[model samples]
Target: MLANADHVMPDELKFEGDKAFFFAALDRADLIVHGRNSYEDQPNSPKRRRIIVTRKVGAVARDTENPNATLWNPHGAAFEAARAQAGVHTGTVAIIGGPDVFDMFMDRYDTFFLSQAPRVRLPGGEPCFDGVPARSPEQVLAAHGLKAAESIILDPAFDVSVTAWRRDNASSAARR
Candidate 1:
């Protein structure tokens, strides 16, 4: 998510470095999980395997238009089962989000790359996490026992930065 210092309205992020970083991660991931809204927003994303989380039940199937995509209703199916159905047995799964999705995977994330554009502010935009009381994404991650590693300045001209929050006790298998 690309947000201002306030971490609001992450909908219209257009930072080149942020996009590059996200695509780089996507390139390395075997599966991608995201909310319905996020999936709809990225209509032209490269043809990679993806699972779209939704509340409606029994709609889990490969997208007819996009063969690499699946519509998953987690309420009706287990995550492992969904992964297996997607033919992803072992490899990195990147969770891109809407706030609810992020909150759902809070405990499962071994590392979260939070990109921020300090110069931009979206006062009424949606937050990174919706219901969490934490003031910032860092606080929310910290609550889940993740600590921030050194931040990378993705774009010095725009004061854009990406901070990685990693779980201290995450098992080696989880890292894989």
Candidate 2:
């Protein structure tokens, strides 16, 4: 996927609302790409084109139930190659991740959707992004020219929706 997302379940996501929408979107994706850790988190399941990006695993046998699943390592190139591959095969792509993966491709991402659970806090756990010092998700996206496009207050679960600043703006791209 040409985008990044971080979700805080229950609060930012609800079993009935946000989570339902999240998985439904995933189901509709032509390519579901995720980091190694995220891949491990999921119960091997079928439905979409699942691609796990990691250098550590080399490759793993496709989950019997999910024959469409496969794995590929971005191999230090971030996801240029993987993106190309996905483009050739499918139009829709989704990226689920660990921080390093997200940071690496955040700038080029066409959209970024973050589900923040306000008021609640985690004492100590994995960060949403790795290798970089603490930076608010909004700041990072702003630096990449991804401004908030939409925000929804879904009662039990309030989620902020963000898409690319503008889908076709070549000028907005942070030219290297």
**What CA RMSD would you report for each candidate?**
3.7, 5.6
Query: What would the TM-score be for candidate 1 when compared with the true structure?
Result: 0.84
- Residue lDDT tens for model 2, 1-176: 11223333223223345455567667666777777656423343454567666665443434344567555666544444555544435466666676666776676667666665553455444566543237766666677667777665434544433233322357435443
lDDT score, candidate 2: 0.54
**Model 1: lowest-lDDT 10 consecutive positions:** 1-10
Candidate 1 off by > 4 Å: 1-12, 40-44, 132-134, 169-176
lDDT agreement with native, every candidate: 0.75, 0.54
Per model, state how many residue pairs clash.
Answer: 1, 0
Candidate 2 to truth, TM: 0.68
